[model samples]
Target chain A: MNTVIDTILAHRSVRNFEDRALTREQIETIVRSAQAASTSSFVQAYSIIGVTDQKKKEQLAEVAFNQDYVVNNGHLFVFCADLYRHEIIGEMESVDVLPSIESTEKFMVATIDAALAAQNASIAAESMGLGICYIGGIRNDLTKVSEILGTPNRVIPLFGLVVGYPAKINDKKPRIPLEHIYHENEYNSEHESNVQELQSYNEVVQKYYLERTNGKRSDTWTSQIAKMLEKQSRMYMKGFVEEKGMNKR
Target chain B: MNTVIDTILAHRSVRNFEDRALTREQIETIVRSAQAASTSSFVQAYSIIGVTDQKKKEQLAEVAFNQDYVVNNGHLFVFCADLYRHEIIGEMESVDVLPSIESTEKFMVATIDAALAAQNASIAAESMGLGICYIGGIRNDLTKVSEILGTPNRVIPLFGLVVGYPAKINDKKPRIPLEHIYHENEYNSEHESNVQELQSYNEVVQKYYLERTNGKRSDTWTSQIAKMLEKQSRMYMKGFVEEKGMNKR
Candidate 1:
């Protein structure tokens, strides 16, 4: 209904971008908006790494499974769940904070903080007429990504936000029906109704894929999810996170 | 620079809300904007439970340690990291998907998805002249919160988003300096430089609190963070998440 709502609704991941880097002002504005997001208990437990070096971008692109867009975007921002600063605060104040920092609750706070900031950054960039895509592929090899970025312990790079001028805008993908995703007062656990709703949603997704690919690809949402989930990917994530000195509790 | 960015930059948690519930249209619009957020690999692994029942709100307020805003807001939305629907999809398609669904990777994906959507909802509500606050306090007792919400397995309530008209607007909390939070090309790991920046930031924060509380409170940011982190809170989150069939790999 308003400019902000319209901007949020029009969001779509842009993988193809025009060959132009963003201005310093644009990047600052976006990051500033990101900083304005709510932090849990005033604990701003996140950081952003702006990858501008061509060599570093190339390395990140490799870590992201050779996604050229990772390097070719106007700018790449690695959103990291960082508690290292809190560790520093602990040292400065002479407090033993490791017990709480290593707890899973803090990990959730940092992760959520990073995600909320990244979303604000995405919306800010989109408002400036830039297209953004979140590169979750960076997690495919967290160790390598962390090494390349020189991130210290307790700082896990969760994802990358690629912002650039879009070469082409794709049609919006349909989301789950509001009724299916939104529960009133309590969660709707009616199995039969849920299954029926999902079945109808499957048809809608199938049609979208068929139309998008000119009938070359038509798969139901359930089938796609099932197939993807059948293959266990990134099984080492738990160990990796723990090894990074987080979520050890 | 624009309306969207302006709305995001002006964000502040609104706890004192006007005693008026949101219209159905406002809730639908906000939820619609939330759904438009980017999901990883099209796996929409999250759900929103909007609590409207008075009794349910009171129970949630209790779970949130008697934060009356939990019950007094225009709307209370519990953003959940949900994978139960994916499990149901596996059952429908006769595929074993538990291995991947329980992986730390999927857990991160679901949690990020929920946070991104919640941020969008918050911005959308704010854009419409409403106030929003993220209720991380609901996380204090997640099991009881889940029971009250009637959530099934594989659905962990991450946090709540309270939206309403504001009865009072407090001064915005100052964030970390952009330089402190944003690193260039690589992580800025110089301990001395970081400590210096943080020391400077502590002054700004101390001044804000001092002014806001009429000199009654003047604590440095580092001291506040250190004090908060020194206390062990929510030690059962990891086990709770594992018991709920997530991040168990």
Candidate 2:
């Protein structure tokens, strides 16, 4: 009911952005807001690449599988889980930093740090009456993205944020009921398989797609997920992340 | 510069908490804000378990290597990157979901989703005049934490959040220079190894620790990270996530 919660719940990833560019002030506020997010152990292990050059945007859009919004949004910011800075700092101090960089825990920490910053940026943009979309599809080609951004080893582009004024608004998608996604004191699965939760949500999603796409696809949530997961998708991310020298174990 | 940015930049993880509990309304508002965070697709692939019982908190604190905030906070919420609900939904519809569950991309997505949610929760709590801390140490013994929480397969506790009134305030830690974190156009490492940026931050961190701890530790960020990383920390998370039936590859 609070303004913060209201902002959080009313979120819908906006793809169609107004043609007008965001003012310099807005971008500064957004990025500064991003910096304000809490970092694990104050390591601040993340970086963001702001892309406005049309050609660079086009390349990134293609890298994100031609997600046009990457090219057309008010701005595109690629968030990277970066430990490279830590390495640089260590090198300046003539100290070792790899043991922290190579482990899964630190990798997850950096990943989460980037994510927290991205969300803060998203919320900040939205607070100013802007629309935004998270471009996870950016990971569709990590190497190309790193190449485009001049990212070195020990940095991985976790995801991108496309911020803009809303040209179109998508309907709010239904989330699972609280009972299914929440537990009281311990991990409770008694209701995980409950038909009441599953069947009802399926119906909601079925109607969502039907109405949203003008009946182009009439499928339930379960069916959609099953279809998406039936075949291996993005299986190369492991080796790709390893190639980037992240979480190499 | 706005209220949102101010709230974010002012964020300090408070582990020393006043001995008071969050009201039902407060918890509801905070959790709802968490639920509102963006997810990869509409998967909503995350869950939160709030631990209130003294015994349960004690057990979890021990699991987190005796992080007393887990037991002392107004509330403790364990944020889990959960695919188990998707699995259950898949089962109700008679389909396979492991392929998606086991991939690095999906694993990263779920982890990011939980992090996004947790940060929102943290911000919401802060906005409500509360303090919060993220407990990544929950992963120190993921299996034991899951056991305490009764977590099923495909659901891993990403981290814990301790929310309460601040009993103590830590001085703000200085982050790296904004230029270092915000790159323009491409992945420009042109200044990544700049000793100028490195030395200034080292002094800032060196002074921060020295002043905060009454000169108990006069270490710089580089030296601290170097010392911390020189030895292995949390080497068990990879195997732990795998044991939880996530990212099996």
TM-score of the second chain in each model?
A: 0.98, 0.95
Encode model 2's per-residue lDDT on A119-152: one tens digit a residue.
Answer: 9998889888899999988888888888888899
lDDT of 2 by residue, B1-249 (tens): 556667777888898999999998888788888888888877788999988889989988988879888899899999999888777766766767777788888889899999988888888898888999988878888888888899888888988999999999977777777777788886656554556667788898898888888989898777777776666778877777777787666
Off by over 4 Å in 1: none
Clashing pairs in 2: A149-B186, A149-B187, A150-B187, A187-B149
lDDT of 2: 0.83
**Model 2's DockQ score:** 0.66
TM-score of chain A of 2: 0.94
The candidate 1 chain B region of ten consecutive residues with least summed lDDT is: B185-194
Worst 10 residues of 1 chain A by lDDT: A185-194
Clash pairs of candidate 1? none
Q: Tell me the DockQ of each model, to 2 decimals.
A: 0.89, 0.66
The best candidate in terms of DockQ? 1
Cα lDDT tens digits, model 1, B71-125, are 9999999999999999899999999999999998999999999999999999999
